[model samples]
Target: MSDAEAARALAEGHLVILPTETVYGLAADAGNAVAVAAIFEAKGRPRFNPLIAHVADAVQAEAIAVFDARARALAEAFWPGPLTIVAPVRDRDRVCDLARAGLDSVAVRVPGHARARAVIAAFGGPVVAPSANRSGRPSPTTFADAVEETGAFAAAALDGGDCAVGVESTVVSVLDGRVSLLRPGSVTREEIEAVVGPLDRDGEGHRSPGRMALHYAPDAPVRIDVVEPRPDEILLGFGPGVGALRWSLSPSGDLREAAANLFRRLREADREQPAGIAVSPIPAQGLGEAINDRLRRAAGFVG
Candidate 1:
């Protein structure tokens, strides 16, 4: 669909599947409670897990969220990129209570995708968008995946091509003069600490999306750090020396490439209908940290 058409759909309180730097999102008007409720119903998402409000830029983000020094610093450094900041709501009335899940704080971000920014700018307001797939499914990185997995529920789908970052944005909660890492993504804790100086690294008491233990999972069971695949399992290989494999996240052990291919590879692996998926080990550094986070969640790790 065209950008104008997507904006019109969002203005009319309809959901649109749009691409972000991280993943395709199921977006709706953040101020419209009815539209936000439709997002929950369409995704089968639990209300307690709040949605992130995406905007065109830091100015639009600050309009809804009360950003303090640290939040502002991070936003200045990472706006138009993969970083989500959780802060107190500046105007509770402006952001529908349903979007924040009745919490005083809201998770907000300025996506780096040009098409997403254009859609938000054209729509003329903040949009409450979560990953454009059913609850607990792997986030869609390609337009075709978004259509195959989530297009049924959206009013329109905007094809912005494959996501660059692949993983979701790094989510940090800056409340009460304290900064805490809620969910690890493309932005690493080390990167955030460099700008904000020492982070709390806490993940509790916040309603940030993608924090659910079993999220981003595929239909088949997943096995992580596996050296050899079971007879009935399909292996998702990372580096060489892994015999036959259903798919390879990266052939040269490049984490950035691996991160980009993670979900799409899992989706392809699951399509084989294997009893389980054995995944080669990924280093927990750089984008690999984010990739492993999703893999661990996909493997059903709680907490």
Candidate 2:
């Protein structure tokens, strides 16, 4: 659909799947309660977790959030890119409580894709979007993935191509002037600290949409064979056990390359459904954290 066509549909309060620097997001008019509800319904998402509203820039984000100097500073440094900042509600009474799950805060970001920015400019209001997939499923990097999973929703989607980041944004919550790392993504904690100073990790307050104990899981049963998984199990290389198990991330233990290849590996492994999958623990560093993060979530890693 044309940008105008998409905007019109969104104007009438409909859901849309749009690409961002991080992942493809199913978007809806954040200002319209009806439109936003459709996103949760379409994805079978619960109302307890709030949605991240996407805007073009500070001007738009300010309309929806009460940004402090820290929030604004971080936005100037990392926004129009892949950083999601949590802050106190802007015009508290004005923002729909449904979007925040009745929390006193909201997660907002300015997407870095040209097409997404254009859509925000065209749609002319904040668009609340979450990973465009059914609840508990792997997030979609391609529009076809979203279309295939969400099935048929009346809203429009911008096929702006694959998300380069291949994951979600780093989420920082600024509460009481203290920064907390709610979730980690492409932007590392070190990078965020460089911008916002040392982070004070507040415990995840509640069941945020993306903060599931078990998230980003494929529709297949998964088992991480850290040691020798099981005899009948589909084996992957750890140090020296590389057999034909349909797929393996890398018997090589290079986390940077591993991070880049994660989703692709998971999708390939999912295709086989060969008993269960095995994983080698790469040293936790740079991209390793992210790689482990996805795996932990996929493996339902708690604490």
Candidate 3:
């Protein structure tokens, strides 16, 4: 579908599947309570988990949320990228309480996908979007999977090819004069710290999204840090020397490449109906942190 069509669907309180750098999102007009509620009902997502309100630029973002100096600096450095900032709500009417999960704060971001920005720009307001998949399922990173996952619920679906990042945006909260890392993604903690000092790893009471303990799961069971896969399992390998059953994320051990392929590979492996999905060990640095974070959640190892 065209951007104009998607925007029209959103304006009429309908759901639209949109692609972003991170993953395909099921989008709705943030200001419309009925539209935002459709997202939760379609995804079967928990009402307590807030949705990220996407805008065309930082100017639109600031209009919805109160951006502090830290928030502004981070926005200046990472707007139009995969970074979400959770801040106190400046315009509750623009981003309704339902979209914010009834919290006083709202999670907002400027997506780096041209088509997504075009749709939001055409809509002329904040769009509350979450990964286009059923709750607890792996997020769709391709147009085909997005349509297969939740197309029935969307009024229109925009095909923007495959997502580049294949992960959700890195979410951080700039509240109470402190920066807290709510969720990791393609953006690393080291990079964020460089921009705004250290980050509070323990974000206790923050209303950030994507914090479910058993998220990004697939139908098949997942086993992380596996050296050898069981006979009936599919091995998702990393780096070189991954003999037999070689579904290598990156043969050269490149974290960025691995991050881009994470969700797509998980979906592919799940389609095989294997006994379990085995993943090789990935380093806990850079984009690997986000990759491993998703892997751990898929394996139901995260608490």
How many residue pairs clash in all the candidates, one count each?
Answer: 0, 2, 0
TM-score for each model: 0.97, 0.89, 0.97
Off by over 4 Å in 3: 243-246
Clashes of 1: 0
Tally clashing residue pairs in candidate 2.
2
Question: Can you give the lDDT of residue 41 in candidate 3?
Answer: 87
| Candidate 1 lDDT by residue in tens digits, 26-127 | 999999999999999989998988889999989998999999988999999888899999999997755789999899898999999999999999998899
Worst 10 residues of 2 by lDDT: 237-246
The sequence of per-residue lDDT tens digits that candidate 3 reaches over residues 254-300 is 88888888888889989989999999899998888899889988988
lDDT of 3: 0.90
Candidate 1: misplaced stretches above 4 Å? Answer: 243-246
* Native-referenced Cα lDDT, model 1: 0.89
Better of 1 and 2 by lDDT: 1
Question: What's the C-alpha lDDT at position 68 in model 3?
Answer: 91
